[model samples]
Target chain A: MIGFNTVEKLKGIVVVVGNYGSGKTEVSINLAVNRKRAGIDVRIADLDLVNPYFRTREARKPLAKLGIEVVMPAEKYLKADLPILSPVVAGLIRRPSQLTLIDAGGNDVGATVLASLADAFRKTSVQMLQVVNPYRPFTETIEGCLKMRDEIEKTSKMTIIGIIGNANMIDETAIEDIYKGYDFVKALSDESRLPLKFITAPATLLAEIDTGRFSCPVLPIERQLVPPWIKAAGLKK
Target chain B: MGKILMKGNEAIGEAAIRAGCLNYFAYPITPQSEVAEYLSRRMPEVGGVFLQGESEVAVGYMLFGAAGCGARVFTTSSSPGISLMSEAISYISAAELPAVFVNIVRGGPGLGGILPSQADYFQATKGGGHGDYRLLVLAPAGVQEAVDMVMMAFPLAEKYRNPVMILGDGLIGQMMEPVEFSDRFKSEPSNKDDWATNGMATRNRKERNLVKSLFLDAELLEEHNLVLKAKYDRMKQEEVRYEPYNIETDYRALIVSYGTMSRVCKTAIDNMKAEGVEVAMIRPQTLFPFPIKAIRAAAAKDGCQVVISVELSMGQMVEDVDRSVQGKCPVHWHGKAGGEIPTPEEVVDVVKSFIK
Candidate 1:
């Protein structure tokens, strides 16, 4: 059994973060799709200020077409050098929807934006989580996870509600890899006191794993973010 | 194409658009404000959003909402603003979303001053959030790199589903330099509807989607964190990027730096070359997924006996270097943080001291 669909709906700021190639965007896209499929009004915001390529906001038009409220930086500021935060989000945080997801930049440096929203969080109970990829840097061990958690919380001024264990070996991820990742995140949860929200596996491997064992939930991730290779194919649609 | 002079902030804006990213979110801060000034007008032309956030905090949260819906979102800030954004960065990690962040760094520790400083090294490269995360960090030496990196950042951010940072200092952001555009670089369609929560019609087809970072139970969270660990590991192997200059020489010391600081080191290298100092420099283009292998290999070299970590800060990255060397060679620290950039002559002096 693996981390399966024990959880369908939850509340507060659901965040997604990881190393540069762990498919965090696909997970974000899938989670947005899956939960919305389950009937929850969702508003997703992209917070990454780290890298420019392959950001979730690139999918804004499609997300908007899906009728999902895609909160993002102003296109005018899209290419700005100096970061200019918008006040519109503060109003949203004060009164959250059924589901509000915050997609952040990678690492503590990029994740530090949480501090700016401290006032918004103080106004409401915001549940924060760290998306972990076992294969990424500083995440190979429980200690590394701890360090990462501390930095995020200390910087963001928000407590982490749990962990999202999404482990993959790039496009080569196997079902076994998902299982190993489940155990690893579980271990971190036990040591850190945060709960394990879910385990993610690509749609390709979703069928291979036993869905019964998980105490939390299982997310069937669909990768919409295209690598250069797949962009030209029919996937470009 | 021909090169044209541009500020680091303006370059970032144009480059991000050219990179195929349409959504931009951020808070205003000093020195880097040009980015906001430049983008506010451009967003409307392309049918994009450009909002002036309440604070760095809110902008970060806005980015989170946007990124979760599957969009290319970003923010830019100086030291103080970045400090305010630390909390949301952690949430972004928890959700495992992909986005780009730019830090036009200024001096700090309590808004020390608004000049250039690489002091945030520890915070930036080592995951500035609250969890076991490592953002792919890229330091651009010039305007072209600053712009080019934003183009690369989108795909890289999407490919790994992780945040990638374009890090530089005030000098870089304010300075003007010629840049050449990327070839065959514009985006089309912007087909993002697959998952974004735009309105009711989409949610009607399936269960309403919720983007949250909460887990009530202990066991579930543990299981979740492990998966992130695997992702970080993979990045270490695949995403670590750096630039090695004069590395082929038989040397006694290797100076490691990034962003504006590396340029200073370059000037020193030139002086040392004339003075017959065989010192090499290694600059990490990606600071988060640091070029550890290069550092390790440099430490493993025969004649490369000592490593001197230099930056605009109090040698924070030097600690990582020391960690990388693992005592193979004595990793020394030489830096001046809080807006004090060591001059090229000063860097040369540091090099001279280690000449023996």
Candidate 2:
């Protein structure tokens, strides 16, 4: 029916990069959670120095309880506003787990952080994926997506092997939006010479969506990162 | 300006540009980084400068430098980031240089989780850094209001030659809403020829204009302090802004709040009204020059029973509400910190607890 077959194929160090507000962090978190749920030893690292809100570190307790190691800088440096990476990041990269996902920060400035760790990743099979949200600015068109992919690869010193379509507006996201985004991402994939690994849709929209229309696996997003007011509406943590 | 759906963070960025404050220097922080990201691309197009400094601390100084040169400049940061900029904020205030700062506040004390919180209320209102100075603080409640506030902040900062703050929570920064900007604030670039440290040659003067906050002599420093105090007092007399909701009716209770918390309070009040429970509310638009008189009047209205302070912090602004109430009625506080936003139902229950 759907492509767990493709998701099952995900291995080694997987890094997710995209333009700001492209929902890369959301995809990274769900990917880690899904891998762990699928009986894999998952460890996700938050390298998103570009944004502090909605990063994986915020959901540490739940992910940790699920035996998913959420790695980031130490507690003392959490609010330092400096790009201080945890020493454990290199260790995790060197010795890859069953599923090790890295949620990189947005754009070239953020991708540059991954360049220093490039040597450690050289030993392992690394799948660097660019996430595209058609609703966001740079990823909305084919040319913009291609431009972003070039910039991210140049800055991170890693080639993007695949693309992930993660398109949504918080509460207003609908099924058609996901379908529309797929065509947008497909064109990006063709032009950039990369495969679409998966596309994300909120868990609520899954039943209404025709899984057959999509060529890749659909990543059902369990909306973890939300505004405080929405958090109050029974979606806490 | 036509209505367009935009995130509050991005809208604030566009609003600043629309207001003609093009020089922006900021470090990336959650909830507010979109402002910097948007400006980074948009500023170059507008022939303006957008530079991300080493940290929030460095960005604050960059703002001072640019503003000293008579440029309309600003920066955006989150709670902990603002703490780093506090030192520069004090210096800018003392130097009497006009600059705008937006605080898309998140939970804090130290490394507090990145969720919405009003914990920085005291830090923003009472000087965060060491000095006798005040930032003209404006607390916005929603996305459109946030855009308007950022657009208005520039002129207000220039009017007083002081740092103006747009204090909003993560909710305001992250949410999406339709907004349209007008020249309602009359935000033209302020003429800085009188005191700005732009080159003396440009201003047709021989003496070099020094932009600094240092006064080594005690008497001279005291006089400078006095002059700043006079300006602040004038602001107190003329610049207080607030909104009174359901106050025209003889309500049974009054809830005082600002920023994101005020919206929650409004929802609670509306929910209660449907259940035959009417409550008045006082939402302050300006936090420093708090609407003391308006709050007092609201609290003393004919059928009002008590005043309650609703906040995203433990109770930072409650003290201000208490001072405004001035023992006229019993004052209580309800809040949630560490990113726990109180629900409208919870707020309604809290109100019922006291009244019942």
Candidate 3:
């Protein structure tokens, strides 16, 4: 197993933004759970207003059970697609927990919401990381990845300091996909000059992988933003 | 290209392109606006036409115009948008034009919610429009199947020279899964020179092609209706498709389901088998030329006592199930329409209640 000490570097205000369907909500939930398991104070804001389904708020019960704070719109407006950023989001930004994670929506349109809270983010030591799933459409190549980064940065008015590789085919993920994903993000980090924060492998596949092959930490993804059917079957890893 | 993880909406757009469809017209609606978003950028790169009409009403006519010229055209919309387009759908069907329409169904009667629902079954399978016409409806359960269905829908539409509908739900549009675009389903566009309104000189024909739904003479209109009925009858014979699961186990209760809701029932059946309970399922891939014969045979199995139509709607498909069973055994409807999908545990309990 890989050491999780490197994840300790993810402190203060960290925002997860990426292209559509790049698994930002899953990564955000896992990061919050990982930090909480490490005995750190964590508060996550579900800022994904673009997507109608599969937002971080769907995992509120399990996350709350883990003693991690999950923030989002009020109950009345929970399922609404309206972009309602609660007052508590600014509070989370101003008075940062040990780990303050913002799971932004997908693409430039999604990240545009972050610009509204730019003033609150200015006061904090904020670091944004773009989650890259190489198997997805636009992020299949380094050039596409760079273009997305530019669009997101321009919209959010935030500087992305690192890259997080989250390559998988959902249930079809294999070891080769992980290694290839690691190599792709490694090349991306080299070309873009952004630090390689970490790459993720499904928790089920972690035991089969060698952590020494990569330079950055390996974040074991325990999928949380699944359909209700998968949830009822207890299929979560 | 190798397998790539794609949202169902985006995959539907790409699948149409790969299947030689270059014309797309749409109006944005959740949980399916992503299809328009993906194709808006993609169509330009592929030298295809992507137009966002002023409304779904206008978009329906856009498809009619393009499809009348024998162009392979399609549109994606949610429940309410489809309601607005049903008028055009009747016109297109009357003129016998080939077109594809995809409904990523959301909870609705009137903008009910943006969550997944299967309530549109009646609209898609029966006539949503004002006429005696039926769409060749294909329902896909997962993202990969969505891609395959979208690709196949084009050819299926052209083959029958009528509108074909791909019936999916919000989950099928929003969920991400790995898909590979294979050339297995690709085919050369069918020759439309005989009926297409592509101008006489273009095809070197002396007669101008006319496309219209209005048949003024009563006898001619009756003849046209009979012709349409023949085509529909042919479809009933050749196009029915379904998948039977766990039938070899001599299941006592048979479940009829489709789309995303069927996947939940599948999980329940698998789990129930381990607990020494035998439950079977029949998942319909085509809703219009529904697999009634197969369903009837499955329901008539020796030990089968009850047949249940499990769906995401209140009881839409159950009507078809009841008709298919024809009193072979008591048929029951078990589902929800409030956008809250019945979980596998709930499905197990629902089926268990009938068995005892």
Candidate 4:
């Protein structure tokens, strides 16, 4: 039943990586919050430098208020395109506590940066999750998702222990979409030989969804990291 | 149709496809790469062609080759990539081929930065490549406008037999907004049988059609120049488009802006109006056949004391503003280049200084 309780299984040094636009940031944020609410000491590192938009660091204020420490590069280099990995990311891996979540940059090019810190995870228990969103072009099919998983593992020098299904179209997602997405990810999990840790749905739609339909746990996503325009009107929290 | 939220880059791609443009070729560039990434999947579903060219230079000619065959085609790139495509753009322009190119402008003279900047105004409008030619540049201020302009670019290009550009910025390319596409615009491309290079055998015609910009003789070259100039002049007369804001009564200042920068200015104007300050604006939708007449008219308003050019660059478009004002009133500029966007509050503070 560990698959039905995904966040409960989140132990030391959890890293999330995925193709671009795969909603890894959203999963990272929700996972951190979920662990913290469960009375676990949580620290998340924003290792996303490939995308200037949609990053986990944008939720620093709210996460900090919830007693979750968000580690990131110095303030000046926050928006720079170059990858500036803080020493704290490796330091956390070496002496990880209850839960240390790393929100990695998107794509193989981004996962290449994770290779430098692979040694820290050698001595610790690590679970690298490849967030799969079938809505995105790169992970639309079973073959595409497998290709991405192979590429991420090769570049990061780490193996993906599980898969997270995060499929949604902003404001257009429906109850049927969540089920369809879950089925797609279930097929992906079967073919890729990875456990389905959990699947995500928007918090608004969580009440109507029949969780029995999915074999894995369902995590409710709070919409965050929106564009300047959407943030003006859509802060679901 | 109901509206759906979409990123500016992807929306432009969808709009281009909706406009009956079935061929897309481009190399990936930051801030605008989503356009290519989205089309790479959507194109095949629509039975269209989507290609990632070896380089931006190759992408340009691929667009030319496809456009020469009378295929509705387009490419999207950032500022530095646009510079690489300038030569082909000039060739496409002089050859009078109908193609659509979107430049999600970023800061630059040379790889300046990847953030949004309107530094390519002169290059897009006057001519980036060698030759006396102009691209019909269209600027969109938001995601919905970007979608509309891209859908409009195809027909306008074919109508004039010239290359059309949708000039945007990083902000416009990266942001998201709700948009609804009309079923009306989604149809087959118009006939290009006469000038298209579909092959002499296919057309079953005796005469051979040439698609080239070369003219060896001086006299013939002059004639070609004259013909091209005459077309541009007609465009100026027929295709000048702009939007005027808050010009009903005389105002203290007139802000001339375009594209994403104009949206920031609009926000600033609204904030200032709440504080009892009256400011008018003239947003030019077309940059090449600039709405000089509209800017002049706005500046000529009785109580309009200063004409301010708000832009993302240090002041590229201000020159046009100054020229349009023609020494009638004082002209000024406020901008930030190198990927630093001015906030609405910062813009309002500048407006306060101008009023004082």
DockQ-based class of model 2: incorrect
Worst 10 residues of 1 chain A by lDDT: A228-237
DockQ, in order, for the candidates?
Answer: 0.01, 0.16, 0.81, 0.19
> Best candidate, DockQ-wise?
3
For residues A133-233, could you state the per-residue lDDT of candidate 2 as single tens digits? 87765566788888898899999999999999987765677788788889888888888779899998888778999989988898888877755444411
- For model 3, name the residue pairs that clash: none
Off by over 4 Å in 1: A1-237, B183-195, B198-209
lDDT of 4 at B73: 91
lDDT of 1: 0.73
Off by over 4 Å in 4: A1-11, A26-40, A57-80, A83-88, A107-119, A126-237, B1-5, B44-47, B179-191, B204-206, B246-251
Model 4 TM-score, all chains together: 0.81
Of the true interface contacts, the fraction found in model 1 is: 0.00
Range of the 10 consecutive residues with the lowest summed lDDT in candidate 1 chain B: B188-197
In order, what is each prediction's RMSD in angstroms? 25.6, 5.5, 1.7, 4.8
Worst ten-residue run, lDDT, model 3 chain B? B183-192
